[model samples]
Target: MKKIFFARPYRFIFFPLAAAAFLSLISFIVMHLWNYLLPGLLHVDMITFWQAMALFVLCKILFGFGGRGKFGGGAPCMRQKMEERLKHMSPEEQQRFKEQFSNRMCHKSGHWGRRDWFGEEAKQEDKKAD
Candidate 1:
């Protein structure tokens, strides 16, 4: 028993167990608060309150603990395709592509600095265009 508990393979069990315990605790606390609030605010009964709590827990389990593609297959093929595409690009084209991709990513991510949005060169170009 001690050896089994200390094994590396058993370490994986701890993660899901801890996660489930934490999620259950959160669900219980949230349901308790909702029960307290709903009875005073809207005159709900204990049965209805418990039913809502069960539904909430069910939804949480379905959405949170459900199997997602992140843990499944097909990721390797997608990564291989991306690597192959990158390997096929010329050095200059790759540099340009990387610059444009980073710029678009930065802008779309909404973490732009002062110069990131519109710099002196961009302003000059805008003025020239006008």
Candidate 2:
């Protein structure tokens, strides 16, 4: 995997500063949005900056923080999963699966016709293709 552009030693120096600025900016925006929209539109109380920060944390907890499976969210994205699977496949199987996957993904007609939506029919079609 690729490391960040700056060197590793510098990341400890830079990351916290960047994260603090990002969190402050996001909190400010959320506070402004809540103040501008909710009170007038729905008669809800306007939120303070601290309230907005709390809301942000709450949302991160309820949903997910990022796509690294940190919050016990569902599986990682498809490309990562496919890459891991490909690492375990033999060379010939990997090549064949890649071509077949590309053809089906590109919606080639013979790769998957209308009848392929049905299980038995699809199996028969696959046998015939082979």
Candidate 3:
């Protein structure tokens, strides 16, 4: 009645085989790239296929498996809740809310751009340091 890539028994067999093949291919690429780049560029030793797989796993653990975008970038429902709250606020309240949000997010110094947190005070500090 329904068309599927693999039937019941084949599904179990096919998925694991596919996953293993994918992992193997990825590890092979990682091994080749590390051998090609890092050994000469960073003077790191060339890694084997198993080592590359381990490195991939280690990176996945250290960073993440990849999901959200950035810090404080919450889920869609959270965004909707924020928008609903903002809609209820007055002009002054909205401005205050925006300022608070900016402060918490990437609007301050050490974030992205050259804009300092203390504005001119940070420039003076930098001059003193220099």
Candidate-wise lDDT, in order: 0.66, 0.77, 0.80
Judged by lDDT, which candidate is best?
A: 3
Sort the predicted structures by TM-score, highest score first.
2, 3, 1
Q: In candidate 3, where is summed lDDT lowest over 10 consecutive residues?
A: 110-119
Q: Candidate 1 on 5-78: residue-level lDDT in tens?
A: 66667668889999777766776776687677878998976444446568777887787744445344456788
Stretches of model 2 off by over 4 angstroms after superposition: 1-8, 68-91, 95-130
The TM-score of candidate 3 is 0.48
Residue 13 error for model 3, in Å? 0.9
Q: Write the candidate numbers in order of decreasing lDDT.
A: 3, 2, 1
Cα RMSDs, all models:
15.1, 14.2, 18.5
Which candidate has the highest TM-score of all? 2
Instruction: Return the lDDT, model 2, position 65.
Output: 74
